[model samples]
Target: MNKIKIIAKKNQKEIRIDKFIKDNIRQNISRNQIQKLTISGKILVNQHIVKKNYKIKPLDFVEIEISNIPTIRDHLEYNNIIAEKINLDIIHEDEDIIVVNKPAGMVVHPGFGNYQGTLIHGIKYHFQNSNMKNFHLYRSGLVHRLDKDTSGLLVLAKNEYSKQCLSQQFYYRTIQREYRALIWGNILKEKGIITGFIGRDPKNRKRMTIFRNDEYHKGKYSITYYKVLERFQYLTYISCNIKTGKTHQIRTHFKYLGHPLFNDSIYGGNQIFMRKKYSNKNIEFLKTFLKILPRQALHAISISFIHPKNKKCYFHSPIPEDFQMVLQKCRKIFLQ
Candidate 1:
C-alpha cells in the first residue's frame, strides 16, 4: 500500500481532484480503481471526502490511499526489459481532440510481440483517475495511429462521438496527412505524384508493393504528392502528402519511385551501413552507442483536418527527434 499527498498549485486550480490524483500518482492504478476509491471514501480533498465529480480548487490538498498496487511491466522489451515512460510532446489538446508528437522506435498500439508498455499504456497511466470511462479498451483517446518506427503527429479522440467523427473523415479522405523523409539517391524531379494500387508483395509477405496484376489481393488505390525540399549528394529531403492512407503508403510509394528511405530495411535501402556503423552486435550494445532506430526513416510531420463539432480546420504534431538526428547527420556528412 502507498499513500500520495497532492497540494494544488495556482495553475492547477479548478482541476478535478480525481484528475489531480491520476496525474500525480506513480503507482500503476486504473481509472476505475480510482473512482472506486473515491466512492468508498478512500480519497479526501482538503480533509473531506468528496464525490468523483468534485472539481478541485487552488491550495486544495488531496490525499489518496492506494492498496495492493500491481507491478507494471513492458513486454515489448522481449528480455523482460521494461518500457520506460517517454515524454510525449503535445501540439494541441481540447475536450474533443488531442494532438501529440510521437517519438520514433515507439509502438503506437499493443500487438503480438508488444503486449505491454506502449503509447496507449502511457496514456492510460496518465488518465487513470479521471471521470473519463470506456477509454481503457482504446488506450488513451487515440483515433488514428503512426507506425512504431515512423514518428510524427497523431490525433486522439477525446470521446466516442469525436472518435466516430474523426474516423469518418479519414474514411472519406478528408484529412490531410503530410510526411517528410530522407530518401536514398538524388531525385531528379522537383515535384510529382505517385498513384497506384498497393498491396502485399507476393514474393515478400512482410512488405507492401505496387502490384500490376493480382485479382485476389484487391489492391487499394493510393496516391502521394511529393516535392523535393532539399538535396544531398546521394539523398533527397522530400515533403510528401497523401490523399489516401494505405498501409505503408508513403514508404511503398517511395520504394516504387526507386528511392527507398535512407535506413529502411524492409523496403531495402542502406540499413546494413547504418546497422554496421551504429553497432549491431548485442542488445545492450545496440541500445547504447548505436541508438535503436529499428524502423523506416519516415515521419508524419503534420496532419490537418476539420473539427467535427465546429468544422474548423485544425493541425497538429511535429518532426520527431530521430528524424531530426538523421537530418543533422545528412547535413554533417554531405553539406560539410
Candidate 2:
C-alpha cells in the first residue's frame, strides 16, 4: 500500500477533485477508481473526505491511500523495454502556442493497455511545476495528436482562448500537415491521391480499414496525396499530405495501395523477412537488438497552421531520427 499527497496551487483553485487526481497521479488508476476512493473515505481534501466532483481551493491538501500499491518502476521498465523515451523537443513556442517534436513509440494519450508514461504524462509533469491552470479536461491544452508510432510535430494551446482558436482551424481543415514515411513495396506512380472512407475493420478490431459498405462503421472521408521523394528496389520514401484526418489514415490508405509501412505488424509487413534473413545462431540476440526498432517508419515532418492568437501561419517540427535511420538503411541495402 502507498499513500499519495497533493497540495493545490493558487491556479488550481476550483479544479474538480477527480480531475486533479487524474492529472496529478501517475498510477494506473482511473477516474472511477478515484471516485470510488473518495466515496469510500479513502481520499481526503483539507483533512476531510469530500465528494467526487468537489471543487478544490488554493492551499487545499489532498491525500490518497491505495490498498493495492502501484509502482512507477514497473511502468518505467515497460517504457524502457518498448524504447519509448520521455524526452520532448520543443520546436517553436509562444505564450499562446507550443510546437513539440513527439518521439516514436510514445502514445499520445492514456488509454486501454496504455495507462501511464504517455505524452499526456509528460505534459502533466510540465504543468505540475509551471504556472499553469489545472482544470482542463480535454487533452490538457493540446490541439491535436500524432499516433503512438508516428513521431513529429504537435501544437499545444496554453490557455482556453488559444485552445478554442486552434481547434477551429483543425475542424475547418485549414491546418496543413505533411508526413514522411518509408513504405514497403515499389510505387508505380510518382504522385497520386488516395480518397476513401475510413473506419474500423470488422474482422480486425486492432486496425482501421477502408470500409466498403458497412453502416455501423460510419466511415469518415479521408484523402492522402503522396509524392515519391526517393525510391529503392522494394521501398519508397514518400511525402504525404492529408486533406482530412482520420484514425490511421496514412497507414491504412498506403496499405490499401499495397504499400504498407515497413515493419507494420497490423497492416502487413512484419519482421518475417528479418527472421528469414537470420535463421539460427542465437535468435534471442537478434530479437533483442531488432526490438529496439520495433515501430513502423512514419513521421509527421512539418505542420503549418494558423496561430490561435494572431492568425499568423507558422510551421514547425522536423523529421525524427528513427524515420531518417530507416531511410539510411534502405539506401544502403536496396539502392547501393
Best by TM-score: 2
Residue-level lDDT of model 2, residues 207-264, one tens digit each, is 9988664442245567899999999755688999987777899989998988888767
Instruction: Say which candidate scores most in lDDT.
Output: 2
> Taking the tens digit of each residue's C-alpha lDDT, what string does model 1 give over 240-275?
998777778888998898888866778886433333
Stretches of candidate 1 exceeding 4 Å from the true structure: 1-86, 133-141, 213-217, 271-294, 311-313
As a TM-score, model 1 comes out at 0.64
lDDT of 1 at 4: 72
What local lDDT score does residue 93 receive in model 2, on the 0 to 100 scale?
66
Show the colliding residue pairs in model 2. Answer: none
Error of 1 at 166 (Å): 0.9
lDDT of each: 0.68, 0.71
Give me the runs in candidate 2 sitting further than 4 Å from their true place: 1-86, 133-137, 213-217, 271-292
